[model samples]
Target: MTPEDRFPGPELPETGPRARLALDPLSYGYESGDHGGPQQPWAGPGYGGQGHGSQGHSGQGHGGQGHGGPGGAAEGAVHSGESSTVRGWFEAGGGATASGFDPDAPGRPPFEPTDPPTLDLGAPVSAAPPAGAPDPLPEPADTAPVGPLYAVGDVHGYLGELRAALYEQGLVDADGHWSAARSRLWFLGDFTDRGPDGIGVIDLVMQLAAEAAAAGGYCRALMGNHELLLLGAHRYADEPVQSSAGTASFLAAWRLNGGQQNDMDRLEPHHIRWLSRLPAVALEDGHLLLHSDTTAYLEYGASIDEVNDTVHELLASDDADGWWDCFRRFTRRFAFRGEAGPAAAGELLEAYGGHRVVHGHSPIPYLTGEAPGEDGRPPLRITGPHVYADELAVAMDGGVTMDGRLLVARLPLE
Candidate 1:
């Protein structure tokens, strides 16, 4: 068999994160004398046997959601608008062969200079109830000009669940359009993968973004590690890249980490652009919002804008190793779980300018060790968002993918 055939494809969800270390380009060039040689910090088994992957930040476990069918590629589908410069560079260095890689693949992206995606930001959208639905009670015309600030946890392609959560908060109307005018909503990231209808979820968020802005409100998102993973697979599929274990590729890693085929097939240019440009960090009402709970973001930039801009620029580049570094770091987690957690949170706040850090990557059940409900189902109530690390951090990933709650909390938890 050819080296390509002998090379292992993506791992199973049950595989330890150590399996990932083999694909982390950053893990290459390191010389360790350990069993598998000097393994990197992320090059280990699951965390404390809690089932966290070696990818560290991915909370996927045996029971975790995201296990799905392989994303099938449309044979011979060449990526259109691909930058010849990027293709040339990769080809020059024996980068992954682009010949048979699926062009419609979700990850490999091309550069296009377009205005940052904006929701309508135009005329006010009239909230009209559907037929047979009672007219919604009118709010006082003098309601607060700027509505409440709220955030959502991970929605791993569970579009129905996300819609329900938003609707419960009155953020969306019965028809699933933005209903809360003048209200700000933020999705903490991980909108796709590991469940059904990831693309549908992105579509909804995109629609609501426009609808919300048109109604004098705004809906925004943050970048998650999965987004980084998807991009890497798209850009460097089957490319033999350096790794601690020898050679690896993003396509294999993405598949093992719950890359949904439907999501990839349905991916469009707009979706790629939007995901690529998502901010890595943001401060709102003294709350610092991050997608993952790792301190690795500091490696990207010294400040919030710097971090986001740096990440965005990196995503635009054709550097395979650079992209892997970003993906690896973003997959780190548990920076605020132990005694030093508060201190870690404080460090982010000190640098990023926020009173508290709000994040969603590690699920709440995993953090608290809360067992699933009776009958092996997820618990009915999560109570509320987890305020931990001496109240310096709040975790919103309620483990929705694991049948856990999908938390939607207002900012500035008191």
Candidate 2:
């Protein structure tokens, strides 16, 4: 069954104070070496033991609840209170597997191995309702302004930073998960690549969508070029393709961009299928959400859904060069940075039907001249989530992968 179908709990109420759910801290295990007991493997690619990967999945169960109060605790497991334990699971196998237990399986016992496992107990346990308990519908906060929309820039596998930024924005709790009620969150894409835990980032976002929807809010993500590249590499790695710059291959680009060897090794059929099905653009609350800030979308279709459908159809084709070109064009950034950038921004606004365009493919630091190692220049600080471009575009990418902040903010009604 689909996640929505599997998680058909009561919808959170549309009017009330923000409902808070305390999450118990959870633990996980990792295999060391091929023997799967925390030892480095000395042989061929190690699958480890069946139960050596569980840390991140434990945390994922409570991701939609705001991160606050006492964290949950794991029952009958060794606890390694290291956030890296969660990171390792996402990065370990390139995020191919789901680390957490299935929430839908209420009676499924936790994985128990015969051998001692590398355990990670994240946070303390909380005595909250059981996973299958009927959740009270959360009421919407009338006091808050309407059209409470938010956009996140590229996550790029920096799960810790993304969580911290979400908390800072009051969207999540201290644990780096979502919690706000009756709010809308739009991710501008590029969730993986060039950092640790790209897979982890995607897993978190996917989990949040279920959580947020249950809580009377919504979390939606756009398809970024990196996602396309990752999917392409997994499906068409051995297939060569032509590019604007020259002949290019997704596998080569993925590796050059620090694609984790573990990720490629763990590329699963489901992950590729999900990435392939991602939509290209999303529009909500008078804002346009996309990965890149270019007018090239006109080449696809007129309506937002049409464009997404067209792109999906193209990606499904066997024409490797066409797919690569689409990936390359989407990867381009800084279309709204310079003096002439406003014109390009206007063209997009005219097509996409949003007063403002929110995107993450290009980070805000790169636009404001604060990115590290930019010709020996010092980094610049991002003061807020919204960056106005000729008063038509909002750059949401906070450059979290490069030590910049992650942008998270509610959309203000005009």
Candidate 3:
């Protein structure tokens, strides 16, 4: 059955902080040398024993509930797509011919590849001055009126749940239009897969983006693993691609991970362009935000700016293997769990310049090893974002796939 069929409890009966769940001693996958190796300080497998074929994040079904799917910063944002973990179960080998970059293929991006894509890096536009140029003066901070900042985690495909969450925050009016005047909003990605109405969710987010910008506020999103998967499936279809463990095709992987046909059928060229334009990571108000909780982002660049640039550049390209590689690295999760969790969060913070790392991808219930009620225990009640890794990282995915709430929270959590 699908994640939606599997998890049918409640769509968030409560809100706010709840008691912390006890963590299992061996909750984190941690089998070292899977990829990061010893050279990378915060490297290891996702969930325990998960490898290229291991289960990291779960996918959901139709309606608005489900699970889904992360990477590194090179010079810009995560170009290698935060270096995701590959999930091809068969043996690795493929004989497919070159099959990307066709204009008719969904891989043919509609966005102008020439544009710098600096629209939402969220990083200050300062790195190195021109040769022999004096360092640029620090710009004045804006004192303009601004609304509160809020973040929504992995919507999967649940449009209704997302609408309620946004309405609860007064972000949208009764008519479901952007009503947050000057309030800033960010979607931590995973807009599709495992649920229904992913396209609808994207439409709402796109609408909000335009309306919010016009209102002097803004709506933005990060790239999620499912986005990459959907893009790949559209571009390559059933064409086989090589992965660390085996040969897999984008179409198969996408479907295996809760990719719905309706979303694919309704996907428009404009959607492709918008998805391609999204950055893999961003930093604002002292918070570093991303999709998955993996250190593969380090594989992309050394800073948030570099990581975002790299991801955009890659998505704009027609290289199917490169796209698959990107998807694989981001899939590797559980970086901020177990005893090494704090250190993993530290790696991203020290490199990216955020006081704390806020992310979605790994659901809070899975982090505690029980997923609440799954093992015959009472329902694992998730009321708010999970703060762990010594309080250095916050998990925003509320496991909507498991009948959990689609979370939306104010930033700078107390």
Each prediction's whole-model lDDT (CA): 0.60, 0.51, 0.60
Model 1, span 180-214: residue lDDT tens:
77788899998876666778988888887766655
**TM-score (C-alpha) between model 3 and the true structure:** 0.68
lDDT of 3 by residue, 147-188 (tens): 678899888888889998887777776666777766789999
Instruction: State residue 348's C-alpha deviation in candidate 3, in Å.
Output: 0.6
What clash count does candidate 1 reach?
A: 11
Give the clash total for candidate 2: 32
What C-alpha lDDT does candidate 3 achieve relative to the native structure?
0.60
Off by more than 4 A, model 3: 1-145
All candidates: TM-score: 0.68, 0.63, 0.68
> Whose lDDT is higher: candidate 1's or candidate 2's?
1
| lDDT, residue 75, candidate 3 | 18
How big is the positional error of residue 309 in model 2, measured in Å on the Cα after superposition? Answer: 0.9
Measured with C-alpha atoms, the lDDT of residue 66 in candidate 1 is 20
